[model samples]
Target: MDVLSLIGIILAFVAILGGNYLEGGHVGALLNGPAALIVLGGTLAAAFVQAPMSVFKRALSIISWIFFPPKVDLIGGINRVIGWSMTARKEGLLGLEAVADSEPDPYARKGLQLLVDGAEPEAIRSILEVDLYTQEGRDISAAKVFESMGGYAPTIGIIGAVMGLIHVMGNLADPSMLGSGIAVAFVATIYGVAFANLLLLPIANKLKAVVLRQSRYREMVLEGILSIAEGENPRSIELKLQGFMG
Candidate 1:
C-alpha cells in the first residue's frame, strides 16, 4: 500500500474541513447534498461523454493504483536479465526456453520466447517495441480519461453554481432563504474545484506515473532479451541494464 497516498487523502480532508471550522463556519454549511449531486453527477456525465468505453473502463480498473500501485523492482529486473544472459551463454539461446516458460511477466516472457526462437536482435526489438509502446499508449490514454474529468469538473461546478443561483433567484421573494440559498449555490463551485484538484487530477497523474514505470521496466526487459539474442556478455548486460535504475 502507498502510505503517502493514504496520508495525502487524510490531509486533504482535514485541511478543507479544518479550515472551514477555523473560519467560524460549521460542517453543515459544506454538506449541501444538492450541490454535491450537481457537481459529481454532472462531472461524471461529462466524463462519460468524452471518454470511450474501453478507456473509461481502463481508468476505473487502474484507479486503485493510487493506494496499491503495481510493483516495479529495478534491481530485481537487472538481476533477472543477468541470469538470462548467463543461461544463454552456457546453454546457448535455445536454453532460454525453460526460462521463457516460467517467466511471470507476459511482456518479459514474450521477449524471452523471441530469444529462445533465435530471432534476430532487430526483429526482437521491432516486435517488443511495438508491444511496449502499444501497452504504454493504451495505459496513457486511460490516465488521460481521469485528466479529462479533471478539466471538466471545474466547468461543471460552475454550471452547478449557475443552476443553484437560478434556484436562489426564483426564491428572491423569500428574503429569509436568500442567505442559505446563495451559500448552497456556491458550494457546487467549491465541490468542483476541490474534487478536481484533490482527487481526479491527482489520480490521473499517479496512474500515469505507474504506467510509465511499468513501461520502463518492460523496456529494460526488452533490452536484456535483445542483448542475449545478440550474444552479449552477462557483465556487459548487467552494466547496461543498471542504467535504467537511475
Candidate 2:
C-alpha cells in the first residue's frame, strides 16, 4: 500500500475538520446528503459525458494506483541482467539461453532471447525503445483519464450549485425553510471544489509520478541490452544503468 497517498488524503480531511471544530462550527452543517448527491452525482454524470467509456474505465483503474502503486525492484533486476551478461560473455551467446529460461519477466526474457539469437545492438535498442514508448503512452493515457475528470468536476459543481439555487428560489415563499435552503444550495459548490482539488487532480499527479519511475526502469533495460549486444564489460553496463537511478 502507498502510505504517502493515504496519509496525504487523511491529513487534508483532518486539517479541515480540525479547523471547523476550532471555530466552534457544528459538523452537522457540513453533512447535507442532498448537497453531496448534487455535487458528486452531477460531477460523475458530467464526467461520463465528457470522457469516452474506455477513458472513464481507465480513470477508475488509475485511481486505485494511488493506494497500490506498481512495484518494481530495480536494483534486483539490474543485478540479474548484469549477471546474465557476464555469463554470456564468458561462455558465449548460447549461455544466455539458460538465464532466459529461468527469467520470469517477459521484458527481460525477450531481451535475453534477442541477445542469444545474435540480434544487432541497434536492432535490440530499437525493439526495446518501441516497447518503452508504447508503455509510456499507455501510462500517459491513464493519467489523462483522471485529468479529464478533474476538468469536468469544477464545471459540474457549478451546474449543481445553479440547480440548488433554482430549487431554493422556488421555495422562497416558505420563510421558515429559506435559511436551510440557502445553506444546502451552497453545499453543492463546496463538494465540487473539494472533490476536484483533493481527489481527482492529486490522483492524476501520483499516476504521472509512477509512470516516470517506470520509464526510468525501461531506460535502464535499454542500456543494459545495448551494452550486452555490443560486448561491453558487464561491470561497465551495471555502472551505466546505475547512473539513471542517481
Candidate 3:
C-alpha cells in the first residue's frame, strides 16, 4: 500500500536534486545542519507546543500511515456483511454469536454484539455513529498538527536564512569568502520551503487521506449493521453495501 507513496517521495527528491546536480549545483551546499535543525527540529518542537501531548503523540503515530495505510477491503467487507445478514435472517440473533466472536475490528465487533443483544436499529446506529465521529475527530486533530508544522517550517527557514546572513555580514572583510557566504545564507530558505512542501505538507495531506478512507469504511460498516438490524434481506443488504465499493 505504501510502496507507491514511498516511490513518489523519492521521485520528487530525485527530480529536484538530479536536476540541480545536472546544472552544476553542488548537493553538499544544501546540507547545512543548522538550516535543517531550524526547519525540521523547530517544526517538531512547535508541534509539541501547539498540540496536547496525547494529540501530538497520535500525530507522530499516524506519520507512518503516509507510507503504510490500513487496507480497506470494501468488497470483502460487503460479502461478510451479506453472510451475517443471511445468518441473522435464517437462524435469528443467536446465530451471530460465532461470527461476532470471530470479528476482529472493534467497530464491527461492537455492531455484531448489539445485534445479538437485540438492540433496536436506532440505538445501534446512534452508538456506532458516535464512536465513528469521535474517532474521526481525533484523527483530524492529529492531521492538523502536521498542517500546523507545515505552516511554521517556511517562516522558521527564513529565520535561519536571516541568522546566516547576519554571520555573512560579519565576514564582509574577506572578499574571497563573500560568494560562499551568500550561498550558505540562502540555503536556509531552501531548506524551509523544500521541507514544508516536499515532506511536512504532503505528510499531513496523506494522513488526512488515510483518515478519510477509514471514515468511509466505518460508515459502510455502520450502514451494514443498520441494514441487518432493520431485517433487510441479504440480497438487498448486498446491493446497498456495494455502493461503498466506489
Candidate 4:
C-alpha cells in the first residue's frame, strides 16, 4: 500500500477544510450540488470524448496503482535471470523450456520461450523490444487519460462559474437568490481547480511513474534473456542487469 499517497489525500482535504475553517467558512458553504454536478459531469464527459473506450478502460483498470502499485522486484528478477543463465550454460537453451512453461509473468515467459527455441540474439531483442515499447505506449496513453481530464476540469469549472453568474444576473430582482448563486459560482471554481491539481493530475503523473517502472523491469528481463541467448557468463549478465537498478 502507498502510505504517502494515502497521507497526501488526507492532507489535501485537511488543508483545504482547515483553511476554510480559519477563514470563518463552514463546510456547508462549499457543498453546492449544482457546482459539483457541473464540474465533475462536464469534466468526465470531456474525458469520455477525448479517450477511446479501450484507453478509458485501461485507465480505470490501473487507477488502483496509485495506492496499490504492481510489484517490481529488481533483485529477485536479477536472481531469476542468473538462474536461467546458469541453466542454459549447463544444458543449453533447450533446458529453459521447462522453466519457461512455468514462468508466471507473460513478458518474461515469452522471452524465455524465445531463448529456449534457439532464437538469434537480434531476433530476441527485436521481439522483446516491441513487446516492451508497445505495452509502455499503451500504459502511457492510459495515464494521459487522467491528464486530459485534469485539463478539462478547470475549464469546466469556469464554465460552471459563468453559468452561475449568468443565473445571478438573471435574478437581480431577487435578493434571496444572490447568496446561493455566488456560492455556486465560487465553489465551482474551487472544485474544478482543486480536483485538477490535487487529484486528476497527480493520479496521471503517478500512473505514468508506475508505467515507466514496469517498463524498466521488463527491459531488464529482456536484456537478461538476450544475454542468456548469446551465451554470456552468468556473472557478466548479473553485473549488466544490475545497471538497471540505478
Candidate 5:
C-alpha cells in the first residue's frame, strides 16, 4: 500500500474539516450533491473529449497507484540478471538460454533472447535502448493526459458556478434561497479546484515518479545486458550498474 498517498489525502481532508469545526462552520453545508456531480461529471466529460481511449483506460488503472503502488523489486531483478550473466560468462552464451526461458519480465526476456542469438554488444544496446525510449514516452504521455485534465477541471468548475448563479438570479424573488444558491454555485468552483489540486495533479506527479524509477531499472538492465554481450566480468558490470544507482 502507498501509505504516503493515503496519509496525504487523509491529512488534507482532515485539515479542512478541522479548520471548519474550529471556525464554528457546519460541515453539512459543504455536502452539496448537485455541486459535486456537476464538478466531477463535467471534469470527466472534458477529459473524455480530450484524451484517447487507451490513455483513459491507463489513467483509471493507475488511479489505484495513488493508494497502493505496485512493487518494482528493482534491486532483486538486477541482481538476478547479474547472476545469470556471470554464469553465462563462466559457461557460454548457450548456458544463459535456459535462464532466459524462466525469466518473467518481457524486457529481460527480450534482452536474453538477443544474447542467445549472439547479437553484438552495440546491437543489443540499440534494441533495449529503443524499447526503453518507447516505454518512457508512453509513460510520460499517460501522465500528461491526467495533467491536462487537471488544467481543464478548474475552468469546467467555473462554468458550473456561473450556471448555478444564473439559476440563482432567476429565483431572486425568494431572498432566503439566494444564499443557498450562491453557496451551491460556488461549490462547483471549490470542487473543481480541490479535485484538480488534490487528485489529478497529484496522480500525474506520482506516475511521473513511477516512470522515472522504472526507467532507472531499465537503465540498469541495459548496462548489464551490454556488459554481458561485450564479455565484461560480471562483477565489473555489477559495480558499473551500482554506480548508476548511487
Candidate 6:
C-alpha cells in the first residue's frame, strides 16, 4: 500500500473540512447528497458516452491505485538483472532458461526467453519496445477514463447548479428560503470542481506517472537483457541500466 496516496487524499479532505470550519461554515452545508448525485451521476454518464464500456470499466477498476498504488523496486530489479547477466557470463545464455521460466513479469520473461534463445539484440529491442508501448497505451487508456470524468465533472456540476437555480427561481416568492436555496444550488458546482481537481485529475496524472515508471523499468530490463545476451560485462550492464533508477 502507498501511504502517500492515501494520506494525501485524507489530508486534502481534512484541509477542505478544516478550512470550512474556520470559515464559520457548518459541515452540513457541504453534505448535499442531491448535489453530489447530480454531479457524479452526470459525470459518469458523460464519461460513459466518451469512452467504450470496456475502457470505462477498466478505468474504474484501476481507481484503487489512488489508495494502493502499484510499486516498482528499481534497485531490486537492477540487482535481479545483474544476477541474470552474471549467470549468462558464467553459464552461457542457455543458463537463463530456468530463470526465464521463473520470471514473474511477462515482459521480462519474454525478453529473457528471447535472449536465452539467441535472438538478435535488434529483434529483442523491437519486440520489447513494442510490448512496452502496448502496455503503456493500455495504462494510459485507463488513466484517460478518469481524465474524461474530470473534464466533464465541472461542466456537469455547473449544469446541476443551473438546474438548482431554476428550481430556486420557481420558488422565488419564499424570501426566507432564498439564502439556503442558493447555497444548495451551488453545492453541485462545488462537488464537481472539487472532485475533478482533488481526485479525478490527480489520479489520472498519478496513473500516467506510474505507467511512465513502468515503461522505464521495462526498458531498462530490455537493455540489460540485450547486454547480457551480447556477453557484455555485468558491471557495464549495471552501469547502463542504473541510469534509469532515478
Ranking by lDDT: 4, 1, 6, 3, 5, 2
* Selected candidate, larger lDDT, 4 vs 6: 4
Cα deviation at 227, candidate 3, in Å, is 0.9
Please give the lDDT score for candidate 1.
Answer: 0.90
Estimate TM-scores for all models. 0.97, 0.91, 0.94, 0.98, 0.93, 0.94
Cα lDDT of model 2 by residue, 1-246, tens digit: 999999999998898778889999877887788778777777677777777787677767767778998887789778977997789789988899988888887777888899989999889988988888888887778787677677777777777677777877888888777766777667767777778888888988999988888888878877887788888898898888888767
Q: Candidate 1 — worst ten consecutive residues by lDDT sum? A: 176-185
C-alpha lDDT (0 to 100) for residue 26 of candidate 4: 96
Local error of candidate 5 at residue 170 (angstroms): 2.7
* lDDT of each candidate versus the true structure: 0.90, 0.81, 0.87, 0.95, 0.84, 0.88
- Measured by lDDT, the strongest candidate is 4
- Model 6 collision count: 0
Sort by TM-score, best first.
Answer: 4, 1, 3, 6, 5, 2
Runs in model 3 lying further than 4 Å from the true structure: 176-181
- Model 2, poorest ten-residue lDDT window? 179-188
Clashes of each: 0, 0, 0, 0, 0, 0
* Per-prediction CA RMSD (Å): 1.0, 1.9, 1.6, 0.8, 1.6, 1.6
What digit string (tens of lDDT, one per residue) describes model 4 on residues 1-246?
988899999999999999999999899999999999999999999999999999999999999999999999999999999999999999989999999999999999999999888889999999999999999999999999999999999999999999999989989999999888988899999999999999999999999999999999999999999889878999999999999999
Question: What is candidate 5's lDDT per residue for 1-246, written digit by digit as tens?
Answer: 888988988898888778889999878877888788888888788888888898778777777766776677777866886897788878898888888898888898899889999999889998999999998887778888789889988988898899889879998999987876788788889888888998789889998888888888888888888888888887887778776656
How well is each residue in 1-246 modelled by candidate 3, as lDDT tens digits? 688889989998998899889999978876877677777788778888899989988998888898778897788888888889999999997899999999999999999999999999999999999999999999999999989988998898888788878777888998776766566568878888888888888888888988988998889999999998889999988889888778
- Of 1 and 5, the candidate ahead on lDDT is 1
Name the Cα RMSD for model 6.
1.6
Top model number, TM-score = 4
